[model samples]
Target chain A: MSSGLALISIFVLAVFVGFEVVSKVSSTLHTPLMSGANAIHGVILVGAIIVASHSDNTLQLTLSLLAIVLATINMVGGFVVTDRMLEMFKVKKKPASSDTSGEVK
Target chain B: MSRDLYDLIGLVAAICFILALKGLSHPKTARRGNLIGAAGATIATLVVFFYGDQLPLKNLPLILGAIVVGLVIGVPAARKVQLTQMPQLVALFNGVGGGAAALVAIVEYLKLGEEAAEKAGAIGAAVLIATIFTVVVGTTSFTGSIVTFLKLQELMTTRPVIFPGGRFVIAGNLVAILVCSGWVYSAADTTSVMVLMGLSALFGILFVLPVGGADVPIVISLLNAFTGLTVAASGYVLEATLLIVAGTLVGASGTILTRLMAEAMGRSLFGTLFGAFTATATAAGTADTRPVKSGSAEDVAILLNYARRVVIVPGFGLAVAQAQHTVRELADLLTAKGIDVAYGIHPVAGRMPGHMNVLLAEANVPYDQLVEMDEINPTFPQTDVSIVIGANDVVNPAAKTTPGCPIYGMPILDVQQSGNIIFLKRSMRPGFAGIENELLYDPKTTLLFGDAKASLTKVVSALKSL
Candidate 1:
């Protein structure tokens, strides 16, 4: 099969997958959801690396390096920020040593 | 790595991205999901170093240096960013990602010289289409996100900046973009591609300028989707499988979220895009002139102690004051006394969706005590005291009773139905949307004028004495 055809098929199928995975998220988690999705698109860093490595001129190297730096920021910052946000939502477990009423409710 | 082996790694990375998003759907798995996504990114980044065609030796230092620089800036910024400024942070990060995608398209175009242009006619139309799409969408997302960052940070006016013939100017930009796209399809040169990117960027700034401050959440979500599509376009150009899947996933999900945000505000997507909520002229002259009762912290405490049940409505003001901890303490005190205490959270309460919930969760408030607007609205009639903290528009009765009001038809917490309403606000200044809240003017509601943290602390102290 042609590379274009393969890409098109993957693109169409991924759209459904994206919708299915995100639709199950509750409203209370929308902020984290946005952050997570933001990080996923940071995959562009791969493309930046590719173009930057092959750059033969100063202009090409500069543009691609800028892309690399920006893409790295998007990837690293997006995931770290998302993780920080999601960590706050974890359900707290009571300490085993506490004898008093430590019930969450 | 060989080409086939590289393809295998890409496939595995794509699956990891899918699993990451799946894990994020539930709070219990969200943190783990984020880690999984990061792992996927790490794998993809590693694979780039092993590309068989590009030896990777020449750019190895540059790539590593760039990664280190990004970590230096992104990590500290993300860690230190206040929860209140999360929207701006997200905008900044998202903008950089879009800028990266646009740069990729530009470098690709510049690399394709006159010799390659003549040979490119046989490479298939898909590549050309993807290149054009990447440049247009990517540049638009880049400029649009920067403007959004400025607006959210208050460095620029949050109000809409519409001028005469604005629509025509935006329309002209779009038409020029179409012409440029056609030009690239035929000529396939760097100049045409640059022109396309510049025009799209201009349109992006104009596109977001007309949106009001209160409606920024929807705009942010929309731009998030745009960045995703741009990445997907670049994925097509690079023939990278993981980018295509992950990008499409983000694009679809962000679009859905943007639409849902508009609906949560009781506005259609069309209305949100064109009829932005706060055009200064339209919302003017709807002054709510009427007598209102005022109360002290002691009075509010007395009312709360005697009340059978109490519901608290938390809004952006609570987050701004960083009073979630105090509010949670107050609720704990009320709950221990056997007086019912529950929170009412509006869908669009804070600067971003679910922002209020995240703030309360950070305070260790039991999730069960936090009730959504739909589920809590009916219970208001049975409550004795409804304490509204730093909230205005979400509890305003004008949304329901006033016909011509700007926020009419937007669903709000039914605080007015309760026997007594106590509002904690700095003054009678209208909400972000600049609509005068009629609920504050109602006789049943009493205003408590003070900072939310100080006011809530006083109320907690007064309740303790009783």
Candidate 2:
């Protein structure tokens, strides 16, 4: 099979998998879901890195460097913000909520 | 690193991305899910660093410098931004991804000259198509996301900016993008490709400028999907497995979210994109002249103190007033009196999807106490008192009763059906959709006018006095 066809197959299957995975996320988690997905696209940074590393000219180097910057921002910012938001939903273990045997709930 | 080793690493990263999404389905595992996704990114970056193709050692400082600058800007912005501004921040972050993808494709295209293109032969077809696709979609998402961020940030008018020939201008720009894409595809002209990128960016601005703020969330989600598609195109250019898998996943999920948000607003995808809610808001503002019964915070407190079951309906106003913590205090006080207090969260209650949930969660509101519109609507009839805080559109009765209303078919919280409703509002203004709420005029509803925070504070003090 052609590599193009192989890529298409991977793309189609990934689409299905994507839909199925996030379909059950409760509405309460939708914001985090979005930011999480936003971060996933940050994988584009790898592409940026490849192009930048192989750049042969000053112009190409500059453009590729810009890509690196923007992609880095997207990757770092998206993940950190999502983690912060999700942390608010976490149930902190406290002594006041401990069981009679000193085991925390 | 060998090709086989890099592929294996990419596969592991892809698996991590999938696990991350799966884990986010429940709040219990969401924090770990985020961390897992980040770990995947770190691993992917590391593998690329060790890949056989040597990026010149001299350029190492430049690459690291660029990343340091990105960290400086991105980290502080994410940490300092208020939760109320989270939607706009998300839009801005999504834009940077698209910008990066577009730049990557552009750099790759520049590396391919006429002789190189000739040597590439049939594979040149794939390269050209991917490069052109990435340029068009990525640039569009980049500029479009900026416009959405501006509208949401209130830097620009949230109302749709309509002109006499606005649709024509947008249509004309889209055609330009198409013509440019065709020229670059067939001729392989480098200049035409850049022109196509410029036109797409212009079209993006025109595309989002006319969309009202209420619709920005859907637009952001759509742009996010566009960014994902662009990344996938970039992946093809780079031949990286993780990028392909991760980008397609993001693209699909973002599309679903866009659809869900549009459905919540009772709009089709196209309609939400072109039809501004401001047009409806203006029409409804003038029609409702009926007097509403106004009450003091003490009066609302009295009704609440006597009630057995109290339901709270919060909207964007609650977020705007930064009153989630105060509202939680009132709920806590009510719970202390043995009153069964619960929250009704409309699906599109805040600026972004699940925005109200995050805001209230930050205030320590128990997840169980917060209920979806479908689940909580049924219990409203049994509710003795329903307090609406800075909410207008989500609880509006016109959605069901007035066929002529723009939001007539939209689903809303059944706050009007409760035994009594005390509305907390700044004025007699309509909601974001600009429709007059029949619920406000209902005898069972009492309007309490003030800043949401101040009014809630007074009510809390009043309950204390009792």
Candidate 3:
């Protein structure tokens, strides 16, 4: 197998495992997980953009630019929204009270 | 321009992904971790676009158009969905990822041509694997998630909708899927592979149908894992760095979640899948025809006000009626009159574990006031009133000693220990597991049958007048 082909094959197989995994997360964590995963999707954007910048072909260039912007938004927006929601879990610190878990310790 | 830059970006992206995952374990830094990871991913994608020579750049509008379409749907969906609805939304999004991966793989395969399919043997293997995974999981998630959404939203019954020959249908679909998967594994023709994908899609739908609403969390988790795998496969087909990392992180996290969900229900992953239909069969021993001892809300409120110590137990009905804030107000008013008020939270209360606690916490209920089932159960006898709000299963006494009861072995809140029990509900409805709550008809129990929000509000108003 060619090195390039091997890389692609590994990538494809990894995705197969990826699908099976995401379908099984706990409900308590979906929002947080999605927010985190969306940021990771930016890696795709960065890679696509990098490919486009160096490519002489118009197709690669356009795909890369488009991927970059979408990836950025998905990543950034996901985080912002997730953070806002997580705030609901945050315990506002009381003076001289340092309880984090808020479980009555 | 240098190769080192791309490598550096990839390394950074990996680190970000790891840190984000770690941060996600704890709620505090999870959002920041998610953002940082996303940034790293964006950088990684940019680096790859610059360095990768294989990216197709010809269809300029196509790429932009896809992004635009994603935005139009994604933005509104994210904005409008409530936190409670996040699970289904995530399922929908994950399905989209798998579908996208499958589409990308198919496009790539067609582009490579019949001549290259054999010439680029290893590439063909990758494409075949990625395309097959993406299509199967994507189609499954799309259908299964829609079903889950319907169940959660009450558009469909929570009961196990068993058909006369459900198992045979599912078995047949599974066999066909296995044969198709085996053929796809051998690098079959693109058209035939696509046809196989259709069979897998049908299989996914049948696989989820027998599963009752009680197992939705597990189903959702499994579907999420499928989506991650599909995205990773798409990454392989596209040869993109971002897709690979993103897919791996999602895949890893999703797998962990599936394992956790199985654990939450005290079952193994395969056990849950193979015997998922058992939840329906288990419904046979449940109490469905039990009657509730109904009372007026005003009378129940008066009784609660007269009590010296009152414990409030909130359930899915409270969440469904959006009554947390009202219940909180009731607690405060009772407290003002020298009543010791506390909330009894069952472990497996509501749709998910700790769901009641989350809702109560959202209403600013003091942590000290919220007691777990174990601690509060023993204290129930000392309490004067135990008020159940939109709850059924957790208070049922059948879970204790009634071996034939469906929830026999499961621990429940000891509302039965209270001298006076008031249950606030909209109707004499059974819980998600379709089990009758024996406590509802107990001699000590008085059901204030009404919508949780209105009932709680009325109770608060009555307490205020006192």
Candidate 4:
């Protein structure tokens, strides 16, 4: 609830937004964007951890705890799902027998 | 003086995210990227529950309720959704992101009323503005994206499904936006905020509904961008640094993807906007579309080996059979015969964009052998052969000559030029684009009915034996 904390949050968020807009024009990093952003989820985790540690107020602590949990899930689960999806791209060698056809003999 | 190990956990998660992203650039390393991201997210969330104080004591039930409800719906949906419908699924997920952003903003705003802006310390006017911006865009992305999913899945019409006085509905949205914007400037309270939120949701729905089904790819991409922006805005409100950074990346990348898809379709952004959503099927007098032509594997196989330039246009059929390796084998044999071989890739070929590319790349087809639709279409006519392995829409002559057809004006593969054409399809079923391929009946087109991989390998054998 402190004005100081609120200001820091807004400034931090704004800078990130600015970074995002700039990155939009730079198309070189298309595939890795999600991965990069996933790391930022860690920042939320850190903030929540800090808040939990700072606030004796049960309500604040609980919320921060929840935020950390959700953020971690998103970061971890998102990466897992995305990885599996990408694996679909890997051409698996078919059973040398059936998954393929023969050269005209 | 406080030892917050939670911060350390968060920092660790962040590092994972970075590694995950770097790993996702190529198929070979993408799994690593995915794993790192998941690890980061998991750690982040666990730390939140263990440390954060945002969830009120009495409202524990609310959070619990949402998790329960979300699991019920999300789990089943994930289980049942097919790979062919994965694009729509992605749209649906993007919608969830928007919904989450809006909800987060709404909850935060509710807290603001209780905390009084003056007492809430640094919650400045800019924060309020950013929060509202995110809510509005997020709400819009949510509704618009769901509608997009419906359209793509054929649960709704693919065309501009305008109603009586549809233009009036749009004008009214403008009025609602003005009213909401006015309230945000005045009362700035939760009641006014709620009304504004309603209007924002309405505006989002209005913006997307009129977009024709033909533009779903771009629309989906745009909605994804909007969700990113919304999350970024929410990050602003929450003062969550990493949230903002992650959200912005999604926004930027999604925007570029939208622009790229738009360009590939030969439509200006404005051109797509002006077109009414139209899902009207284009099947008609074509009841007489040339009688289906059939071919035996041995007969067709002989023609393939003798041909000079051969373009293999892959489709969803290949994926259904999981036949990437077989395709590669066929291509290898042809290449060895000194035949020019290339894979013609349509932008929207297969169920989702880039699917054929993923499948072919898995088969280890040389990167140089993979050609895009634009690069390959022109060469089709001069080619000695075109083996359409599960492709339909892109090669559909209807895109070129048939007006009023569902896929009219869409670009197609110029396979008509090949001296010999072989179409391998399971049946006469139309492609996802919902238009019959006139290419099926071309005198030059010989239809080989079977699993695509089987037909292709059969042809390969004929070529090698001769």
Clashes of each: 0, 1, 57, 55
The segments of candidate 2 whose C-alpha lies over 4 angstroms from its true place after superposition are A92-105, B55-58, B114-123, B187-190, B276-282, B287-289
Tens-digit lDDT track of model 4 for A1-105: 684465456446544543434232212123233323332332333333333344444554444445434433333333433443465445554444432122111
Per-residue lDDT of candidate 2, residues A29-59 (tens digit) = 7778888889889888888878878787898
Off by over 4 Å in 3: A1-81, A91-105, B1-3, B45-49, B54-56, B114-127, B182-190, B237-242, B267-271, B276-280, B283-291, B354-358, B371-378, B397-411
**DockQ versus reference, model 4:** 0.17
State what share of the real interface contacts each candidate retains.
0.74, 0.71, 0.19, 0.12
Shift of residue B201 alpha carbon in model 2, Å: 1.1
**Tens digits of per-residue lDDT for model 3 on B1-466?**
5667765766677667767766665656665666666566555644543554444444445455655655665666666666555545555555544444444444444444444665864445656666667667756765776677677677887766677777888888878877887776665566666777688667766777666565666777677666666666666666654466567667767677667655654456664565545444553444456555788767887898788888888888888898888888888787777687888887656765545655666778776677777678888888889898888877777667665444555567888888899988777767776777677778898988789999888777776776
Q: What TM-score quantifies how close candidate 2 is to the native fold? A: 0.92
Give all TM-scores, in the order shown: 0.93, 0.92, 0.81, 0.72
Model 2 chain B: ten consecutive residues of lowest lDDT? B276-285
lDDT of 3: 0.63
- Rate residue B272 of model 3 by lDDT: 50
What ordering of candidates by DockQ runs from best to worst?
1, 2, 3, 4
Note the DockQ of each predicted structure. 0.53, 0.45, 0.21, 0.17
What does the lDDT read for residue B417 in candidate 1? 90
Better of 3 and 4 by TM-score: 3
lDDT by residue for model 4 (B410-459), tens:
67778887788888888887765556676777788888999987877787
Cα RMSD of all models vs. native, in order, equals 3.2, 4.0, 5.3, 6.7
Q: Please write out the lDDT profile of model 1 over residues B1-466, one tens digit for every residue.
A: 7888998998888888888888888878888888998999899989888875757547789878988888898888899888888888998899899999999988876776543766754444777788888888888888988998998888998777789878889889999999999998777667788789899999889999888777777887888898999898888888888889889989988888777677778867777678743333564346666777889999999999997788999988898999999999999898788777889999878877788877888888877777888888888888889999988888877788776565778899999999999999988888766677877878888899989999999999999999
CA shift at B258, candidate 3, in angstroms?
2.4
Please give, for residues B43-79, the per-residue lDDT of candidate 2 as tens digits. 9987787775563433777888888888898889888
